[model samples]
Target: MNQVIELIQSHRSIRKYKDTPLTNEQVETIIQSAQMASSSNHMQAYSVIGVTDPNVKKRLAILAGNQVYVERCPLFLVWCADLHRLKVACSLQDTEMVAGTTENFIVATVDTALAAQNAAIAAESMGLGIVYIGGIRNNPKEVAKLLHLPELVYPVFGMCVGMPDHDPGQRPRLPLELIYHENRYDPEKAKKGIEEYDQMMRRYYLNRTHHSRDTTWSKEMAAIMRQPNRKHLRSFLEGQGFRLE
Candidate 1:
């Protein structure tokens, strides 16, 4: 395989980071690479807030379910789905802009995700470790207030980036047969693949945790699906002016 493919396959979520901060040149390169990611209609409906302030990071860490990594990481980037800029663009032309439709919301969110993934890849290429903090969504309203987000804009997620302090081995993913389909989905193949993967994951968890924990992927997924998570996000989005109609 080529180096890029190998790099992509070797990806891991890093939780621990060294005390070293990212150089200004490194930060600039990563952000510029993110900006090059493809966007819907070239709208580039996203914004990234790079946080280096210790005080702000501390508050964000608490808001994100006390994920200490948020505060510890040398650089924390909040990727946002932004429509406020588009609203202004319309105003500049003396035109009315439909602020929050379902399609627009989807587009903006997708754009933000795509850009953030590019940034992640860029950081990895530079030997910097990074982790995406979805817990930021746990208290979206508080996060928005802290970041001073304007109307028609919302935080999509946060990324913590810095030098690696630990090497957490990569987690195994589902087999290709389960996810890849020819013409139509093959349920039988997928079923068999999932069963095999469950056993693999059970062993993985056991080994990774030194026998402290032994759980199958299916079991973990079941636990996750048993309850509604972040139910407040719907109301929170509406309050942020994303009608999602």
Candidate 2:
């Protein structure tokens, strides 16, 4: 297999990191790779904030569901879906713009995600470990305030990047056939794959090198879907000027 393909296959979410800090040149290279990611209509509807200050990271750690890694990591980044620039484009033409609709929200959010993923892959390629911090949304308002974000911009997620203190084995993924159907959908085949996957996950959770849990994929998913997760996000988005319409 090609080097890039091998890198892709061995992806892991790294939490424990060494105290080593990334050089400014390395940070620039990673952000440049992220900028190369495809964007909707080239709007690039995203901005990234790199945080290294201890005080800022401490507050962010608290705001982001008390994820200690946010404060401990040598590099922390917040990826924001931003429509504020588009408004500038409109103003340059002496015209007003409206982007509060659902479609606009989706486009900007997706652009931010695609860019952040490229940065993550770049970090992994350079032997740096990284973890995505979705808990930024646990208190989006507080996060935005902490980041000093402007209107029409929102923090989609944060990322912690640093040198790995130790290697963590790769986690298992769903069966390929279940995810990749060629001609038509196959519910029965997908169902069987999931059933088999559940057992694999049960063994994995029980046997992994860290804190062990007795659980299966299906059981975890059921528990997750049983509740309305991040229910406040709807109101939060609205408060950020993203209209559901």
Candidate 3:
């Protein structure tokens, strides 16, 4: 296999990191790789804040469901979907930029995610470990305030980067047959594979972690979806000047 292909296959999220800090050159290389990602319409509508302040990282870790990795990691980056730049450009031209719509918001978010993923892959190639902190969305309002994000911009997610203290076992993914369908679709075939994959997940958890119960993937999915986990997002997006209508 190609080196990149091997890297892609072996990639695992690393939540526990060593205390060693990254050099400025390493950080710059990661950001440069992130900026190289292709953006929608060439409008690179995103920004990344490299946070090294212990106080700021501490608050962010708390806001993100008390994830200690955020504060422990030597480098913390908050990736944002930024439309404020376009808005400013429009203002200078004496024209209005109506990017609070759902389409615009989605585009910016996709752009941000692509860039972040590129950065992750690039860092992994450099023998560094990284993990994405989606829990940052748990308190988007507080995260925005902490990062000083302007209107039309929001924190999509966070990344913790550093050397790995321990390499976690590979987390199982769904069988490719279930996820990759032919031209039309095959729901029945996919459903059968899901059961096997759920068992694989259960075994992985039982062997690796303290999770003793045979928690099927379906059960976990239902629990999170049925709960009011993101009920705040609708109103929160509105508060951030996004009109998702």
Mark the regions of model 1 whose C-alpha exceeds 4 Å error after superposition.
Answer: none
Give the whole-model CA lDDT for all candidates, comma-separated: 0.94, 0.91, 0.91
- Evaluate residue 50 in candidate 2 and report its C-alpha lDDT on the 0 to 100 scale: 98
Q: Which candidate is the best by TM-score?
A: 1
TM per candidate comes to: 0.98, 0.96, 0.96
Which scores better on TM-score, 1 or 3?
Answer: 1
The 10-residue segment with the lowest total lDDT in model 1: 185-194
Of 1 and 2, which scores higher on TM-score? 1
* lDDT of each residue in 1-245, candidate 3, tens digit only: 99999999999999898889999999999999999999999899999999989999999999999999999999999999999998998899999999768899999999999999999999999999999999999999989988888888899999999999987888888888887888978888866888888888888878886776768787788898886776798787888888886
Residues 1-245 of candidate 1: C-alpha lDDT, one tens digit per residue:
99899888999999999999999999999999999999999999999999999999999999999999999999999999999999999999999999779999999999999999999999999999899999999999999999999989999999999999999988999987788898996777866888899999999999999999989998999999999999999999999999988
State candidate 1's TM-score: 0.98
What would the per-residue lDDT of candidate 2 be over residues 93-154, giving only the tens digit for each residue? 99987888888999999999999999999999999989999999999988888888888899
Model 3 — TM-score against the truth?
A: 0.96
